[model samples]
Target: MNKDFHYFGTYSAAILAGHSHEDALRIARSAFFVDLCTQPVLNSVGAPIEAATTMLAMEMADARSDIISQQDVTRTWASFHFLPYDLYSERKGCGKKYMQKYRLICKPNGDLLVDTVTQVKGKSLEATGLAMHVLADTWAHQNFAGTPSRVINDTNYHFFEILPDGSERRISLRPNPASPDDLIKGLFTGTMRQGKETSVMNLGHGRAGHLPDYSCMRYRYLPAWADYEEVIKDNPSDFMHAYCQMIYAMKYLKGEGGTFEKATYDTETVAPYKEKIEAIFEKRQTDDSEDWKAFGESLSGQEIPDFDTPDYLEEYHKAPEDKKDDTPMGRFILAALAQKSMVTNRVYKSGNILLGISGDYKDWGTKGIRAYLKLAKEVRKGGVI
Candidate 1:
């Protein structure tokens, strides 16, 4: 989902779960940082640096160690992006099966979240936040498999023009699916990236981009190659369900529950937060704002620390390895790395369930965790990876 859910919505949910404002902010910030921590860099002077922005920059420097590459960075980022799709169902090449597993739609038999929360029980708050992200996604991202497939998301384009008075005029589009030209023409928003034919890397809802992640967006689109039309009218309900799950999860983390029973999204629980979330969405749309960093800062009520800053780096270096887990940055990194590991084991590794491919990637999770830890050590010792 977008920052609306990852940051603001999560913040609201934390409050609803009875967390203090400060703790709620911390939870929300760590959850949101999952999307922002993609850029792992080594500076010109060969010092590992924190991310300056959320934008992906995968290029590696020649002066840096040759062990890591752009592909490694890309895979790492993919681990984060595909976390919600981590389903070890042992079903290969079935998009619907994967979606059902990923989204926890067919419950009792299909829900993996009960097991997921149980495993991470009594873990750090950062881990809870990470789990919450994957949990929340099961609702907003229902029906879309984590892997890309044209069969899941192929679409024809039709444009709409917004007038000065805030009305829309539809513009019809008719391009051959086989040889479409200038696909960007008359498209007002979303990325222009196209996926390769028959590849798992092909994205669902590429036409709508991140629109599906927004709580207030209600859209219907007919996939050119699919049997059924895709719809997202009840996203508010989905968000509400997600909020309830977050509350359940927090309680689970506190040892108040053995299993997460989905909470009732009644008016008393959902109304106040819904109003604020809807207002944020409306303001963003009206302003045409893409400034999620600024928006996140405003919701957080403070400046997020720049990890590259000396004070932050010094604190990280001085912490004992065992005690590091108690620090905020340490917890964040540990949770982020742990989430990446789950994705590697549950999603990317072939033959578990969902999509299967042949390879020896079982150690990917271990390798990635080791890599991050190594980077942490290097940073502590005044070096870079």
Candidate 2:
């Protein structure tokens, strides 16, 4: 068999199986990253940049992948908790707690690689999804630091002040999985508010209020919904882009944004998913301008944009209140549509999407192979076009 003939199948089949192109790409990209870290491969600065593009491209694909149902999203989110520590680990300085949270390792080079820890303690799926989000953030930070960097401090996590009416409103960062963007509000330009009911900050904070020594670190808990809306007001385009990606990604696979028929576990699910699919079929005879136009445009493909900006990213700032409810589906649709151009442009710039899979990489070609396979699946499933 020819070495190049490693893959054999129709792209559509992959899609029907319910996997996204981006997920496939990420598996491949991850393989390449692993190889580079393991093998003594020489590389240029362009290599890492290209690798970064592949990472984001796969993410875009995942963000747009089809969701057959909200349950699917929930299950997938849960499954992430099982991801092995070795797959995405990094070392931290010194602490005995949260050891399973992640692992520490040394690369072939002197750079320390912190692996992403995805398992949720006590087998909680909701906790797992939250864990994945935190891990994504941690990976983003570690990747940027690139070498001999700590992923988290065993004793360190974020703290937020829930008292909005009192003087105790504040959010604290301890440097482990600590991102300035996470700590501060870019748009509000002041301290972040911790919502009374839903604290977005707490989603990342993990083990909070439970800490016996709560006063050890100060916390300002902002209203989750308010902060969410404020995020939109502060940067309508960016918030729209972010939420759009999440919604559309769920919708692409499930045929509706995966909000549930009713709220379960205190969260919204996709009644919209079922309704939108029905509406699409029901409205079929009545002139299909909006969706048809969008579908037609999607064939061209484009890339999703990054939402974090310098201001929102700065330490200890808040976003404005008006940003939450602006232009719902439109934002997501535009972001997903951008994939066509982004992928194509990057491919043209480099010879292939596997720009990061270079230097002493032979077997690791599977990384690229798997990525394309994932892409083919997504495209065929109608989650991506």
Q: What C-alpha lDDT do the candidate models reach, one value each?
A: 0.48, 0.23
lDDT of 2 by residue, 147-233 (tens): 111232111222334332334433443323323222123111121333321221221122222111111122333322122221101
The sequence of per-residue lDDT tens digits that candidate 1 reaches over residues 1-385 is 7665776667656665666666776677667666655344223212223321122423322212222332243234333343343344434565754443333112211234554555467666766776677677666655554434455444445434333345555534332334332222422344343554333223444444554565544445554333454442345456666676777677667676456654433345556445554555544242212343344355445453422334433455567866655666566666555444444445434434332221233333234334455434433443221
- TM-scores of the candidates in the order shown: 0.62, 0.19
Off by over 4 Å in 2: 1-160, 169-245, 253-385
Global Cα lDDT for candidate 2: 0.23
Weakest 10 consecutive residues of candidate 2 by summed lDDT? 1-10
**Which ranges of candidate 1 are over 4 A from the true structure?**
39-110, 158-187, 193-195, 198-201, 223-226, 262-268, 271-323, 348-369, 372-385
RMSD of 2: 23.0
Best by lDDT: 1
